[model samples]
Target: MSIKKEILKTIGDLLMEKLKNLPDGLPDLMWFDKQMGQFVPPETDDTAGGTPEAGISLPLPAVLMEYEPFAWQTTGGNTQKGSGNLKFTIYCEHLADSFPGSPVRDLALQHFDFVAAVHQVLQGLQIENVMSPLTRVLDEEDLAPDGVVFSVISYNTTIFDHSTSRTRNHVMVTNPGLEVKYKEESSRPVPAVEIPAFLT
Candidate 1:
């Protein structure tokens, strides 16, 4: 896989792992698809190649709102650096005691709990050869009629690109006073040259 893709996958995988570790645990939500290499939401029943039951349950707890990436300017080097946003829409359910026309303290607290959990898990997250993670809470809103509260949190992670060229080059350097050896089947030329004093 390309460096960019790998980096994105690493970030998604980490989130999935953290969610899995949650006490109540995460359901089968369409957070990220490894095969698609993007944040694709689960399809609704009305959509092609999708079952109605799935779409009904989807967008359940968490949905990735955006996975926007941008290039980063570094001091100087061949390595490429970048940053991306992973925005999530977390759904919180109203409490059993919560009633209509009254303050939804239960729902509010539940939403905050989910936000805190995500924040604790994502901060300072590290992947090999990549910068540690940084995250912030964007905002929250209550979706009426459905009785579901939504909160948005954006996670920022550093990306490093070390992609290399596909072409291959063979180099042979012969030092002074060293004899070049070749196999019987080899037809490659052997070029002799003087060796630097420091190298010798």
Candidate 2:
């Protein structure tokens, strides 16, 4: 798999393991696909009923994740590095109650708690093979007409791609040999002079 996909999978797995057992219940985790719209719920038997509107009948307390396209720069040789943002959109139905301190009010505002949990789990998180730890960069909320609240949280991280890099291996030499030699003295005018002086 490509680095992008691997990163997404790692994030999803981490979230799943960390957030699976919440006070409310297990949330539906999904990947955001632009072609399929912002949210796509699990497949159900639609034969009994007509096709539901896109994102209308989505399961409550859903977390949708997607990674934005990043611009890559060649670090060296065939290795490239890219810094990008990963977003998680939390969806929950707004269940308001006019009564003060009602349990329903807590349910209505549960998305905030969920958002905090997600942020706590992801902020400063470092994944294997990623160049940097995840840092939260954005947190915003949007309300839809259908009473579904959207909490979008974004994180920034850097990832490196070494798929096209060349593999290099070095061999070690355990034993080495060495040799040394001395040259004989050049022809000897000094030796002939000494012999003539001795004879004299």
Top candidate when judged by TM-score against the true structure: 2
**TM-score (all chains, Cα) for each model:** 0.52, 0.65
lDDT of each structure?
A: 0.54, 0.67
Model 1: residues with Cα > 4 Å off, grouped in runs: 20-55, 74-77, 94-108, 142-145, 164-200
lDDT of 1 by residue, 44-76 (tens): 333332211222343545544445566575523
Off by over 4 Å in 2: 23-36, 40-57, 98-103, 168-200
Q: What tens digits encode model 2's per-residue C-alpha lDDT throughout 1-200?
A: 68777776777777767876666753534323222343433475443322223347556666677777777887766688898887777766665652577867765666788778778888988865555788989887774444667787888888888776654323454655645568988786664444345654
Best by lDDT: 2
